[model samples]
Target chain A: MSGADVLLLALGAVAVGAGALVVTTRHLVRAGLHLVVCLGAIAGLYLVLGAELVAWVQVLIYVGAVVILLLFAVMLTRAPIGPADDLDRAAWPAALVGAGSGLGLAALFVSAYGWRAVEVAEPGTAGLMGDRIFGSWVLPFEVVSVLLLAALIGAIVVSRPDIGAKDAKERAR
Target chain B: MIRPVVPFVVAALLFGLGVYGVLRRRNAVLVLMAVELMLNAVNIVLVTADTTVRAAVRDAGLTHTGGVFALFVVVIAAAEVGVGLAVILQLYRLRDTVVVDDLDLDAEPEGAR
Candidate 1:
């Protein structure tokens, strides 16, 4: 195996392991921390795969914004900092399905592309990504901005019950 | 050259773990974290496919489709988390619990009836 292949495999191991911990760990905050590790490893995977922009974006968004938001939610909800016994439900069914699908897909991938090696492409730098985004993906980019706006408004509206209550009171008057 | 299947298998396992977390976790925030896991798995697949498949199809019109899609997925994930957390907070306010199992869709709110 080439150095890149070894690196890819190692990083993938770290990612999957951390992801497992994220799900199974009883500590709510620890789960968020584990998610940070998992996402960082995946960002490394993206870098190895020659997607520099996507890798950094993963780091910026997933590891930075998303994980922080999750940790904040955990704190706001008053979840236990230490391990909690009631975090998980029965294990058998979840384990059965998880293992079945994971192994099944792994087997399928192994069979379909057994030992096949592919040449690595040029790394996708920000300049190239920008060109593509502004060139062909501008419409979708605008749509995403709109989506973000809507999500912002929706979140604000959903979290504050007084907004709805005020409107109802005004209508009743 | 890296075997393309390596990343594929990793993504598959990650997704499976995500599924397990979603089903097994009682906390809604934890469930959202699991969903993020699944989204990351998909991003891995997309980035890997962009690398391998683009190498093969050198002259394809849209060479960065997968990477672009992965970017869009990231944006969508951010939005989803924001809205999701808001809803979760609202639920916590109303019911004082974030346990997924405790949520009953069929039942009306105590005052609604």
Candidate 2:
């Protein structure tokens, strides 16, 4: 009914639409791009929720860096890009049932526990989030940093592309 | 009327789409995109929660504790993306195909199971 509601709705539509494209599309590269749009919409919703820090970080980490790396991998390894029906067969039934039930359960819980409440917080700044992250959430902070380190190492190991080839040549030698 | 619910509605649709993509797609990049879609859907829910709830999480001058907890979540997402992509890349190298169907890592000898 109000302006804020209208904005939230529009942004929400964007998130869902982009998300659908991320799935239904056939191309691997295009799907990654769609993911960026979907994530950017989530950041917008975060802004509307008054979580500016989370929104930007969502863009920076998920949209900016993560998607780029994914695209690069697709390009480097020559992943299959055909439309010949290359769907996953083994876990299809299980995944559909699990995800569907999970979604249903989430809807029930959210409506029951969260729908009626009025939020107290508004959009926050990087400084505000920074203070909290370093102050009280220090343990998780350390863990994530370590995680980033692990990911970086993993990226180097996996995406190197030359490692396995080099090993083959070494074995031939 | 149905305005505030728009974000939630859209996010649900997106979540469903992500599920389909994750299940149907074979490319690792597309699979990662599906995961991103799911994350975005959750982010929508997170934002909705942040807005609908009454808290001082946003206002630093009040209580900065809860906001810090939220920051932990964001940072964790970042770490997840970084690590997950790297691992996917490695899998591609070993297996040559991102499609889950081709992954016969344990395809040999029925008794091996």
Best model per lDDT: 1
Judge candidate 1 at residue A40 and give its lDDT: 95
List TM-scores for all candidates, in order: 0.95, 0.77
Candidate 2 regions off by >4 Å? A80-84, A87-99, A113-120, A158-173, B1-10, B55-70, B107-113
Segments of candidate 1 deviating more than 4 angstroms: A170-173, B106-113
- For A1-173, candidate 2 gives per-residue lDDT tens digits of 55666777777777767776667666667777777787787777777766777777777877787778778877877865664356454556645854684477458655755534344344567876677666667687788788768766775766566667767777889
Error of 1 at B107 (Å): 4.8
Angstrom error at residue A48, model 2: 1.0
- Which residue pairs show collisions in model 2? A50-A122, A50-A123, A118-B52, A119-B52, A119-B53, A120-B53, A120-B54
Model 1: pairs clashing at backbone N, Cα or C within 3 Å: none
Which DockQ values do the candidates obtain, in the order shown?
0.74, 0.39
Q: Give the best candidate by TM-score.
A: 1
Q: For residues A6-116, could you state the per-residue lDDT of candidate 1 as single tens digits? A: 999999999999999999998899999999999999999998898999999999998999999999999999988788998889998998898888889889888988988
